[model samples]
Target: MGAWSKVRRVFTRDANIVTAEDLLSLAREDRLGGRTVHVTNDSALRHSAVWAALRLRADLVSMMPIDVYRQVQGLQVEVPKPPVLISPGGSEVGIKEWMYSTQFDLDRAGNCFGIITERTGVIGPDGRGLPGRIDLVELGEVTVRAKGPQISKYKICGVDYDPWDVWHERQYTVAGFPLGLSPVAYAAWSIEESLNAQQFARDWFGAGIVPSGTLKNTSKTIDRKNAREAKESFRAAVSNGDVFVHGADWEYKPIQAVAQQAQFVEARQFGMGDIARFFGVPGDLIDAAVSGSSVTYANISQRNLQFLIMHLGPAVGRREDAFSRKLLSNPRYVKLNTDALLRMDPQTRAATIAAQINSRTLTPSEARALEDRPPFTEDQYAEFDRLFGSRSVPTPPPTAPTGATS
Candidate 1:
C-alpha cells in the first residue's frame, strides 16, 4: 500500500485521533511571549466581530439570486437553471443554504470544499464530468495535499478523494501557493487580542481580580489579625449586598477604574474595525466606528453599490466563473444577480424608473416587471388614457412669418 493509503487505514482504525483542542494546547505552550490566544476556525467564530463580518458577507452573497445564461448570437439570453444550481447538495440542501455554508467557509478560511456526490453526462473542457450534486464538507474535516502550485489530493474524513471528484473554490490566493490564504489565520493576532480583552474583562468582573474598594482605619493602627478580621467582615457584608456601617475613623473609597475600562472598550472597537478590514467588509456596515473617516452615501443603494464594486464584486465574479466552469457546459454561464443588493427606496426607484422610461432606455412594461408587477392590461391603459390624454400627440407645423417668408 502507498504511504497515504497506510495513513488513511491507520486513521480509519484509530478511534481517538488528534483533535483541534490538542493542537491548540500544543500551540499555547509554544507561544513566543506576549498574549497569544491561538485562533482556529471554530475559536475565531466565537469572536463577535469575526462572526458578524463573516455572516454579513455570506448572508448577502447567499441571498442574492443566481441565474444561468447563455451567449446567443452576441446577445446574452437567460436559460433555465440547472438542477444542480437549484439543489446543489441534492434535495436535502437548497441553493441558499449551500451558498451560505460555502460562503461562510470562503470568508473565514479563504477556501471551500465539497464532494461531487453526483454528475451529469456533460463533460467539461477539462474532460471531467460536470457536477450535478455537490455536498459541502466542513473545513476541519478535510485535509488537502498540494504539490507545487496545484492540489494533489484531498482526504476527507479518512477517505481519499481524487482532485477531480472534489469541488474546491479559493480566494486570497498568492502565486506559488496551492491553497488560498485564510483571513482568520492572517487576522489571528487581532482576533487573539480581542479574545484576550474579553477574557480579561470577564475575569476582572467575575473573578474579582481587583477589589472594588479599599477600607482604611485612618485614626487607629490595627495588627494583622485585627485588620484581617475587619477585611473579612467587610467583604462578607458586601457579598450579601448589605451596607457596612462604620465610625468616621474608618474610611471607605471605591476603586472605579473608569479609564481602564474605557481602554478595554476602545481596544474592542478598534479590533472590530480591524477584523472588518481583514474580511473586506466596510466598518459601518457591521456598525464598527471608523476613526478619522467621514463617508456619506446619497442613499443606501449607493452604499451597497460601493460595497459590491469595491469588496464583494470580485469574489462574486470568481464564484460565477467557478460555477460556470464546473456546473454548466460550453457557452453557458452563471450569474449571481446583484440587483437585489442595489435596491433603492420607493421614491428613488420610482424616479429612476420614470427617467429610464422617458429616455426610452427601458420600456414601461419592463419597469413594471422589475417591480415584480405584470404589464399594464387593456383596462389599465384605458384608465390611464381617461385620466390623461393620448400618450402620442402630433406637433403642428410652424407657419412661416409673412414678412420673413423663405
Candidate 2:
C-alpha cells in the first residue's frame, strides 16, 4: 500500500501545473437555422454529391502509392520496408488502407489522427520512439485539453494520450483556438443544406411521382375518410401512368403551380454546385451539371491536370509534409508517386518523352523505363554512345524548295 501510494504521488505532483480545461468547452460553436451543424464522417457522407466529391479526393490521394527514399549527396533513391511503410499501426492492413481511411477523415472532418505505439526502446535521437505501429483514431472522438505553458494534451476514445504520442494533421486553425478547424466543419451549413435538399427529394418522390392535386366528387358527398380512401385508391391504381376510368361526377384537377414556387429541380442543381465548390471539387467531376452542358473537358488528361493542380495538389503536399516529419529521420522523405494519374494520349506521351530526352532532362534509358521497358543492354548502350557521344549535335539534311525537291 505504501509503495503504491508513493508511485501515485510521483505521477500526480507537478511543480508548475495548476489547472486544466477541455478545449471543446471553450470552442465557439457554429450553428445554422437554430441547429448546430455537427460535421461527422457519417453526416457529411449523407449528401450524395458531397460524398462523391470526398470519395474522389480521398481515393485520389490514397490510391497513389507512397515511396520512401534516402537522399545521399544530391540524389534520392528508394528505400524498401521503412518502418512507417510497413503495416501501419501494427495491424495487418497495409499502408494503402491506412492512408485511404486517414484521408477520408481528413477530408470529412478537416483533421486526422494516429496514435503511435512504441514497442521497443531503440528510440531515435529526436526521441521518435522506434518505428512503431500507428493506429488511426476517429477525429470525432478526440478532444484537446490545455495544460499550462501552452502545452496541449489529447483525450482519445475517453483516454488521455500525451501530445507526443499522437500525430494530428489539421487543415486550418486560428488564434485562441486549441483545436484545428476542419474544412467540413467550416462548410457545415452548405453540406447540411445539400443533405436537406436530398432528403426532401427522396421523401417527395417516395410518396408519388406526380405533383399534388385536388380530386372532386360532384355526385356524392365526400367525407374526410372517403376522400383519403379515394386518394389512396387513385395513387395505387394509376401511379405509374395506368389508365383510369371514373364516373362523370368524379373530377381530378392538378394544382396549378409554377416551378418558381416549387423550385425543386433548380434547388437540387444549385446545391450540388455549392457543395462541390466547398469541397474544391469540380461539379462536373461528380456528374453535376456543367453550365447546362454535358461537356466538362476537352479530354481526360486536361481534366486530370485540373483536378491535380486545384484539388489534389495541396492534399498531397500536406500528407507528404506530415509523413516526413512524423515517420522519417533526417535525409529521409516520403513521396506520393502521381505519375500514374498524369495519363496522356499515346502520341502526346511519346512526344513528351522525346522532348525530355532531347532536352537532356531525362535519359533515353529512363524514358524507356517510364514506358515499362528494361534498361539499355551493353550493345544498345555502345550504339547510343557511338551515335551521340561526339560534341556535334545530329542534324537532318536540308530539303530543296517545295517544287524542286526530288
Candidate 3:
C-alpha cells in the first residue's frame, strides 16, 4: 500500500506532465479620456511567480503599429498610449471575427490588469485520483477609447452565435463529434446516406424487406453480367443438390448450401431493390430470382419496356431530342437494350448498352441493327400495333415509292 501511494505521489508531483496555461488580455480606459488600451496575461505562474502573461491581440493592432513602450502624454506610461484594440470588433469599419473581452477599469491615471479564470480536467490511469483545478490570473491592461460592442457587436467570420454557444452544439461526448454534423451545406448528404443505407440493408439483410423511400423494385438494379453470373451460380448450385440426392436419401449439407446461396442472392436483390427505390425507380420489375437466365430476363424485361416506351419509342417515331430526355428520366433503357440485343450480336449489344449508360446518341447503324433482330414476341408486335396504330407491312427490299417522280 505504501509503495503504491509513493508511485501515485511521483506521478501527481510531476509538474511538467500536468500544468495549466491560458492567454488573456486586459485594457485600461483612457486617463485623458481617449487613449486606447491593450491587455495580456500569463495563465500558469502565480502572482508571486516571476513571469508575465502572454499577449493575444495582434501586432498591427490598428491601421498603424505603435510600440508598447511609447507614450502619448508622458505620465511614465508603461503600456503604450492610444492603445489600438487588437480584438477586431473595436471601432473597425467592418468586423468579422470572434472577440473575447475581460472586465477592465482605469483610475485617474491609466493603469490596468486583466482578470481571468480557467479550469483543467485530465484523466488517465489513476483515474479518480487525478483532479482538476481552477486558475485565476491578473494581466496589465492598456488605456483605450474604442468599445467593441459600441463599435460593432460581437461578430465572427463563420460563427454568428456567441462563442459560448459552441458548447451547446450537440456532441457525441464519447466520440466528440457534433451529434448533428448535419450541416445546411450538406443538404444532399441525407439522400446519399439514405441511398447507401438502403443498399447496405439489402446486401446484408435478406430480400423482400426493403428500406423505405428507395427506388421502386419495378426498375432494374442488377447489372446484366452480374445478374447472369449470380443466376448461373444459383442454378448450378440447385442442380448439384438434385444430383447429390438420391430418392429419399437426401444429403442435408449440400441442400443447406444451396438454400443459403439462394438466400444470399435474395439479400442482394433486396439491396438492389432498396437502391432502385431510393432513386425513384420501381423495385418490382427487377429480376430478384434464382434462375440464371430468368434473373437476367427479369432485370432486362423491366429496363427494356422502359426503354422502348422512352428512347426507342420516341426515337423510332422521330422525337430524337425528346428521346434523350425520356432516357435521362429513366435509366432502365440501358439494361433493356442489353436484354433485347443479346438475341442479335452480344458484342455490339454490350457496346450499345455501354453507350446508353453514358447517354451518348446511338449511331444510325446501331439503331437500324436492332431493327433486323426478330421481334421479341408476335403478341408484343400486335400489342405495339394496337397502341401505336398498325402500319401496313413493308414490301420486300426493292419496293418502289409509288408517289416519287420517276
How many residue pairs clash in each candidate at the backbone level? Answer: 0, 1, 35
lDDT for each candidate structure: 0.80, 0.68, 0.28
Candidate 2 vs 3: which has more lDDT = 2
Residue-level lDDT tens digits of model 1 in 1-406: 4432433333333342422222223222245664345688898888998999999999999999999889889999999998899999998999999999999988888788999989888888779778989999888787766545666678888898989999999888777655666787667778887887887687567755443678899998989999999999888776545678888899988886556554777788899999999999998888896778879999989999999999999999999999988889978999999997888999999999888877778887888899889988888888877888764322235878889957
Model 1 CA deviation exceeding 4 Å by range: 1-36, 211-262, 392-406
Clashing residue pairs in candidate 2 (N, C-alpha, C atoms within 3 angstroms): 89-134
Model 3 over residues 219-250: C-alpha lDDT tens digits? 34667786676445544554333322223422
Best by TM-score: 1
TM-score-wise, the better of 1 and 3 is 1
After superposition, which runs of candidate 2 have C-alpha atoms over 4 Å from their true positions? 1-40, 119-131, 147-151, 208-261, 292-299, 376-406
As for candidate 1, its clashing pairs are none
- Give lDDT tens digits, candidate 2, residues 56-113: 8878777787888887787998887465676786667788788888887766656678
**Order of candidates by lDDT, top first?**
1, 2, 3
User: What are the models' TM-scores?
Assistant: 0.78, 0.69, 0.15
Scored by Cα lDDT, where does model 1 land? 0.80
Once model 3 is optimally superposed onto the true structure by TM-score, how far is the C-alpha of residue 169 displaced, in angstroms? 36
The positional error of residue 243 in candidate 3, measured at the CA in angstroms, is 47
